[model samples]
Target chain A: MRRFAALVRRDLRLSLRAGTDATTAVMFFVVTVALFPLAIGPESTVLARIAAGVIWVAALLASLLSLERLFANDYEDGGLDLLALSPLPLEAAALAKVAAHWLVTGVPLILAAPVLALLLDMPAGGFAVLMASLALGTPSLSLIGAAGAALTLGARRGGVLLSLLVLPLFVPVLIFGAGAIDAALHGVAARPHLLLLGGFLAAALPLAPIAAAAAIRQALS
Target chain B: MALPDRMAYLTVAMHRFANPARFQRIATAILPWSAGLTVLLLAAGLYLGLVASPADYQQGDTVRIMYIHVPSAWMALFIYANMALASAVGFVWRHPLADLFCRAVAPVGAGFTAVCLITGSLWGEPMWGTWWVWDARLTSVLILFFLYLGYIALVNAFDDPVRGLKAGAILVLVGVVNLPIIKFSVDWWNTLHQPASVSRLGRPALDPAMLTPLMVMAAAFMAYFVTLALLRTRAELLNRRIQVLQMARGAS
Candidate 1:
């Protein structure tokens, strides 16, 4: 447990010191959201109708942008080899990296979503549901994205390949996360959508780490 | 062997054919039969599907698209299942031919999926009043197509062929979880796509006249896949042999 925490802290500090990953992701999120108004015009109803979908998509893309560096840096510098040789289980190590990634990228994207939602003229009723869905959903994105990152390590055109591997898997999260807001806006119960998001997170949390660990082992081999 | 031991024997028998030489011999012997069956069934199916069957009272000739669409859709799912099962065997048992099966089946599966989507769209244009709908079945099948593409890309991505195969095997296992979700998405969502007609618990809702042609076409497609996969796997093995020979020559 201590070793896992230490790994998470080490990743956090490394990302923080380098500083561009989180900021770039957040900035990308903001810029992508900002483009919607310009491209679609400032028509309130049109923007309102698409607000949930736009936010969810932009968040997904922003998280994807930061995913390439998740295992690349460590794998390149031989840090991954030492980690694999460590006494701690590689699954736990994978989980720690995913958690740290969620903290830096997912959290900021969640925090930034509501502000972007406002620009889309999203209903007042949707704010809480939007945040809640993203809060529940983004961790799964980071977890699943970690698996993609591990799978593509040292592969040619890895960044593009990672998106190809990861984006289709992101559909369920997009459906439920955006569905929650859509439900809330229509004065319907958002609970089912939120519950589904939770269900996905619960399933992904345990399974993704195991898959990522296997991929990492293959990469190292 | 006793009943419990029978399964073990079968597994052992299956593994015995994992040797490239043994597999090549068996594949070569079966290829002609498989190719003949594919041609004969396809000819019979197309004649029955296009000419022998009466047009649908409601859908008219557009119903003919279902002959191609349904079978291709079935093959798409079937091939993915085969790939996943083969990948699991490769990973756990280290069977050499299991990964080869995965590599050979992927593009064939993708082609089937594409046929399903394109024919579906053509049928929808006349029947559903649109080229496409966000129907849960169509959407999930589209996702399945993407999964095949991802598998193919991952299998060729690495400089080391063995590493690529291992990585692709893991991915196939991961993507298998999506299969159940895709199969059930229509039932859960109640979208624009028709509910299950053929695979339900009771007898299939399809009429025998319509059903026979569909079954024939499905058999033809299955044979087609088997014939192509065997040929592809044999080619892959030959490629590996040539590469080894070239490397040995360079060293000498």
Candidate 2:
């Protein structure tokens, strides 16, 4: 348990020092959201309808761009080999890494989403749904992206390959995340989609780490 | 063995081919039979489906697309299930052939899935009045197709073939669990799409006439996949052996 926290803290500290990952994801999110208005000619209604999708897609992309860093740095520098030899279990190590990843990249994306939502003229009623959905959704992204990241550790063209592998898996989260906002926009119940999004997060939390650990183990082997 | 025990014997025969040399021999011997069966069954299915099968009063002759679309979709799901099961066998039994089966199965599965998706979209354009819908079934199947592509790509992505196979096997197992969820997501939700027909809990809602050719086409596709998978796996095994022999010669 102490090891897990130490690993998480260590990762957080490293990510903070590196700094570029979080900033790039948020900037990409902002730029992608900002581009829509230019591309679509400033029709607030048009923007409003697509706000949830655009935000979710950008968030998805932002999360993906930072994923290669999840295991690549550690694996390349022999840090992963030491981790494998540690007393800590591989699954726990994976969970800690994914948690740290989520904390740095995912949380910022969530924080930045409302601002982008506002820029896109998203309905006021949808704010809570947006926040709640991202809260539940992004961890799944981190975890799922961890598996892709681990699998692609030394592969060529891994960036494009990672997106192909991870994005399809992200569909359910995108569906329910955007569905929650769409529900709120229509003055209907957003709770169901939000709940399903939560369900996805819960299932992914345990499953993704185990899968990621296996892939990482394979990569190390 | 008695005549009634033939299938059990066949299963044993299939299992024996689980060995690479034996597999190569069996596949070589059966490849012609498989191709012959595929051609025969497909021809019969197409004839029965396209010409002999009656047009739907509601959908007209355009319903012929169902023959192709439904079978491909079934193969898509079945092929994934096969890959997942083979992956499990590889993971648990650590069978070399199981890994080979998974490696061989992915492309064929992806091809079938692509066919399913394309036919579905084409069918949808006329029926649903749109080429695409975010309908749960359609979306899930699209994701399933992507999963196959992902599995295929990941399997080949690694420089070390062993690493790629192991990683790809893990992915297949993960995806297997998602398949039922994907198939049922539409039925579970108040979605725009209709509920599952043949796979539903109660008696299948499809017409008897529609059911017949659909079953025949499904059988033909299964035969086609089996034939092709065997051939591919055999070729892969031979390729690996050749590489090992080449390396050994170079070492000497």
What TM-score would every model get versus the actual structure? 0.97, 0.93
Candidate 2 backbone collisions, by pair: none
Q: Per-residue lDDT tens digits of candidate 2, residues A24-70?
A: 98999899889989999899999999999999999998899889889
Q: Determine the TM-score of chain B of model 2.
A: 0.89
DockQ of each: 0.83, 0.66
Candidate 1 lDDT tens digits, B78-140: 999999999988987788689978998899999999999999999999998999998778988
Q: Give me the displacement of residue B216 in model 1, in angstroms.
A: 0.6
Summarize candidate 1's per-residue lDDT along A59-157 as a digit string, tens digits: 999999989999999999999999999988999999999999999999999999989998899988899999999999999999999999999999999
Model 2 lDDT at residue B236: 78
Tell me the spans in candidate 2 whose CA falls farther than 4 Å from its real position. Answer: B1-17, B190-193, B200-203
Estimate the TM-score for candidate 1. 0.97
User: Which regions in candidate 1 have their CA more than 4 angstroms from the true location?
Assistant: B1-11
